[model samples]
Target: MNLTLKIWRQKNANDKGKMVDYKVNDISPDMSFLEMLDVLNEQLINKDEEPVAFDHDCREGICGMCSLYINGEAHGPDRGITTCQLHMRMFKDGDTIYIEPFRAKAFPVVKDLIVDRSSFDRIQHAGGFISVNTSGNTIDANAIPVNKHDADKAFEAATCIGCGACVATCKNSSAMLFVGAKVSQFALLPQGQIEATDRVLNMVKQMDEEGFGNCTNTGACEVECPKGISLENIARMNTEYLKASLKG
Candidate 1:
């Protein structure tokens, strides 16, 4: 297949970016999207041209590092998959693909297809973890006897990969889905009960400080999330926050 790629290019965070067009030929349908980009980079390098800079680690889709806005969608036209998991077969021959970095105020563009998603790390640091007693007297997690339904729900929420797709897809650029998942993951478990009140409060505060917009329940975030993180998590988070506020 021969394809035209209109990709965003920027030298740095301060540089004004634009879409640059390039063509790739004979692309195999079996190639992953990143592999296709790799082929394009090889072509550029052979011509002494700078290659496009895109974020990617563990192309297996476990790592959410491969964030992108493709053809106006968070991760291309596919559903429930990251950019690296996208296959060339999803496109037709001679198709023109528009690829850009995930757009959000909190996710400023870095270069080319890369953006600063460290904002997510900061939010997580604010309260995503549990305070553990590491004094060699730790209780066995399995011994806690969690309810099966709650345990399943907690595991589901814990599958969030921290990809900015939720932010990018949201018209409000709200991170409610991601934060909700994080909060629900802990809120459902026994170990996380200790920090429940503080966890919701601190994380929500940090999310606001990062310049993320508020959620209006458009549900786009869950639709674009690769892990299919449920919107129900957001409701759970809101409940947690309200309860925490009352307790304080």
Candidate 2:
């Protein structure tokens, strides 16, 4: 296959970025999207031109480090998959693909396809964990009986990989869905109840402080989420926040 790639390029965070076009030929349909990029980089290196920089690690799609805005979609035209998992076969021969970094105020561009996602780490630090005794008096987690349905839902919410696709896809750049998933992961479990009130409050507070926009119920975040995290988590988070506010 012959393809034209219009990819964003920026030297540094402060540099104004622009799209640059390049062509790749004889690309195998079996190659993953990142593999195709590798071919492009090889061509650039042989020509003595700088290679396009993009974020990718664990191309298996579990790490969620491969974030890209392809053809105006968060993770390309495919559904429920990260950019790394995207296959070259999804595109046709001679197709022109537009690739850009995930854009959001909280996710400022760092380079060509890399962005500062440490904002997510800060939000996680705010309250994405549970307190556990470490002095050899810890209770067995398996001993605590959890409702089957709640356990399933909690696992689903915990699948969120902290990818910024939700923020990029949202028109308002709202992070409510991401925060909600993080909150729900703990809210449904018995171990998390101890910090329930503080968890929701602190996480939501941190999300806002990071310059993320408000959620207007557009539901685009869930649609673009690679994990298919449900909107019900957002509703659950809102309820948790309300209860926490009332208790305070």
lDDT of 1 by residue, 9-97 (tens): 99999999899999999999999999999999999999999999999999988999999899999988999999999999999999999
Candidate 1, which segments miss by more than 4 Å at Cα?
none
CA lDDT, candidate 1, residue 112:
94
Q: For residues 111-206, what per-residue lDDT tens digits would candidate 2 score against the true structure? A: 899999998999999999998987989888889999999999999999999988999999999898899999999999999999999999999999
Positional deviation of residue 190's Cα in model 2 after best superposition, in angstroms: 1.0
- Cα lDDT, all candidates: 0.96, 0.94
Best candidate according to lDDT: 1
Off by over 4 Å in 2: none
Task: Pick out the ten consecutive residues of candidate 2 with the lowest summed lDDT.
Answer: 131-140
Compared with the true structure, the alpha-carbon lDDT of candidate 2 equals: 0.94
